[model samples]
Target chain A: MKRRLFLASSIAAALAGCSPIGTALNDNAGFHHALGLEGSLDAALMENLPGLAREYSIADISKNFPVDSLPTPTSVTYDRLLAHDFQSYTLAVVGAVERPLSLSLAQLQRMPQQTQITRHDCVEGWSAIGAWTGVPLRRILQFARPHRDARYAIFRCMDRDDQGTPYYESLDMAQAYQAQTLLALRLNGEAIRPDHGAPVRLRVPTQLGYKSAKWVREIQIVGSFAHLYGGKGGYWEDQGYEWYAGI
Target chain B: MQRLVYRYALLTRLAHWFGAIAVAVLISSGLQIFNAAPYLDAADRSTPTRRVLSIDSPADGIGRTTIFGHSFTTTGFLGWGSDGNGGEGARAFPGWLTIPAYQDLADGRRWHFFFAWIASLAWLSWLVSSAVKGNLAEMILRPSDLHKLWPMQAYYLRLRRDPPPHGSYNPLQKAAYTFVLLVLAPLILLTGLALSPGIDAIAHPLTMIFGGRQFARLWHFVGMLLFVGFVCVHIFQVLTQGFFNQMRSMISGWYRLREHESVGP
Candidate 1:
């Protein structure tokens, strides 16, 4: 009986090795600090290098580009806008800017356009390459004349997730103003599809796919994300994803 | 009579345990990350939603793992298992095999990258210290040891009864350790960096060297399997030779050499 009990306990202990003990360990402040270290390093490295994320050729485009499982926006306002083929859509630029503007989709399309084929890296360890055409975010930010103190550009989308949380993402000013950062109007030479963040989406080729939020409705320039929903900057960020997703 | 000797340095023992823990955490958390997109595809071409290897959980509650178009029901393990919350769920690896024992991709990534940093640093420190202490030279497979590899295997397999007097590490042990320390470690690190989009941005050539990011991921997974194989063999050897003596050497830098074993270096 004694030997049997010892064997049973040993097996239990071995099985417990796969438990959520690591999650509890992560609650410590030191682990939090260590977790942030790599993100800071990534941001610093990008700042120093400022190299372009690899751009693929037309032939390199993914044939069946995987779409994230984002549900179609079905709110009354979204349905109304969708019924009109997004012709009535306007992107509102607000907060910490010299001039807050609500620019129409036509106005955005009329602006000088930049096009590039770049790889889209999903956080889920998959990647796809596609061509995107849109105005550089820098031009729009310049037009708005963001305040020098404004540190982040928060993109609020029209979609609400399963938890009733509005889909949103943010980028630091440096990443926001990257040459490849775009408020994309087209994908693969065609108008964006509803399933793929139609009308307009943020295309950040350098960061993870989540950072490139789809169906972007508003761009809010802010000094800090402390006052945002969940006080964590973005929808996924609020759910514990790293805010700096350059990785 | 059994002889007690300082078989491992304090630094060596500490690094071994530290790296061992870090690697275990890394592998488990990595599987958690892998569960997020449980599919593998070609490196160059765009995958058509499905890939070479895909794990699917149909709405009918059957968990299927498909490899090369071959399907297998791997329920309660690979494709579906208990969620550690008294409910059944679909996930690539079982709950007990993952770090948090739950499905949280973000937290899994956190655990993975955190320990990845630790493991890399530990490996580098050990490499440098061992080299400085001339332990690295001692680990290399000498020409004389090459011929004895088969004999060592034969002895371990019980084909030969009497154990021959050997150095701190047997020929097979030296070869395996050298392969792991030199080849597998560097392969895993390089492939790991190749998986990072941030690193790819700054070091495109590095990713390309591995034949693209997808290939790099495949290589990284392969390297992990090799490491796991090495660990299994290592433990088996320890258990067979003398478990307590091996554990004591690792824990306290002192090992009780068997009577037939030659004196320690």
Candidate 2:
């Protein structure tokens, strides 16, 4: 009887410890932040972590890298830029910065650059490898000189959804400052095509594909994403996808 | 008269039940994720020569199931479905079998990762404890034990009524347990880690070894199916051998041995 009682109690304790109910409750409260494993595992993995994404050789690149569903820019500003071959286009760097600068494509390309062949894993269960060439996001952040209170870097995209809400994504300071994170201008030795994120796109190798905001138009440094569109971190994130998307 | 013998330790029993629950959760939630992208394109016709399985849908954007070169429309049941309003939807596994039972991929992932962590921890602890307790030796098959498997199979097939001389575990049981613990469990965990984008970045070689992330996902799905099959067979065997006795042994750590039975050497 004593043994049975002990076994019963131990099993009950184990079940309680292993239950998802507690985690689900915490998730519902938004105390955990992000979505799914992103809030837990991704956050834990990024805590004070140094550059985590690995670079691959050019030989490892996939011949046919998948082009994710690209949204065409319907705004007049984007259409005018596209009409003029993006010659008059400028990337605006704003919010929580000492020097809020607007950089043209050529000017941005002149900055210190890094090229990496990395794998892009989609959350929907596909992977593609490609060679990405561009300036490191850390260099851009350094140029912007983010304020001490700035905790997140938000990417404002030119693309809009069916509702005309502009697509946007954000990265925590740690990820933004990662060595591999880039504002990619080229893929596979050529200028990025329209099917892929053309002109420029954020390439966060550590994150899932959706976190790499395509057709980036603006960069905003913010302390919190509470006032942003939908309050969640990204376009997909607002619609139930995980914001941290590291996996 | 029957002799009461200790068949399982408290920790072992606890681990067994814990592992079972963890696997159940993992499998169901995994199916939910699989439903998100259900098509497997073994041949990327774009490249013509390069053959690799992809989770991307075919040209028509409709998911298909191919068996020995015969293809069938698996959209509604397999990869895509109706959103309950006659609109096109994506549903992999049915709602009842999934963790959230809704189309929330994020929630499904949380449930999966939560249980995956628990299961992995339990498995590691079980391995360490089993080693310390010298239980590993009993679980492994001996050269002579190979001979016993035939007779056990014959008995199971009803060719012989009497059960082979009682042992800690029958040859078939040992084989099944060994496969589950040493093979399927490790494969599932490794493949799962390979599928994680964050983990893949750190451990590129692990994913590369499996060809890619999609391949890892495919193998992980296959592993879940194998695990379900194993559980079904395990329960059936338990019921046929003596349901109450097996249940009592696992629950109470004591099994009543028949008078004619002798523990194996």
lDDT for each residue of candidate 2 in B105-194, tens digit (9 for 90 to 100): 676677677778789988988888988998877887677788888888998898988756635677887888888988999999998887
Q: What is the lDDT of residue B102 in candidate 1?
A: 76
Q: Report the error of model 2 at residue B61, Å.
A: 14
For model 1 the local lDDT of residue B18 reads: 86
True contacts kept of 2: 0.31
On residues B1-265, what C-alpha lDDT tens digit does candidate 1 reach at each position?
8779887888788788889888888888888888888887758433744366777687545689988889999887778886756677888887778867778888788888777878888889889998998888878788988888888888878899854546767788789988999889999999988877777888899989988877788788889999989986876666555666778888998888786676553
For model 1 the local lDDT of residue A165 reads 84
**Residue pairs that clash (backbone atoms under 3 angstroms), model 2:** B35-B92
Q: Write candidate 2's Cα lDDT for A106-150 as tens digits.
A: 987788778888878778766677899998988888988999999
For chain B alone, what TM-score does every candidate structure achieve against the true structure? 0.92, 0.82
**CAPRI-style grade of the A/B interface in model 1:** medium
- Looking at model 1, the pairs that clash are none
- Top-lDDT structure, candidate number: 1
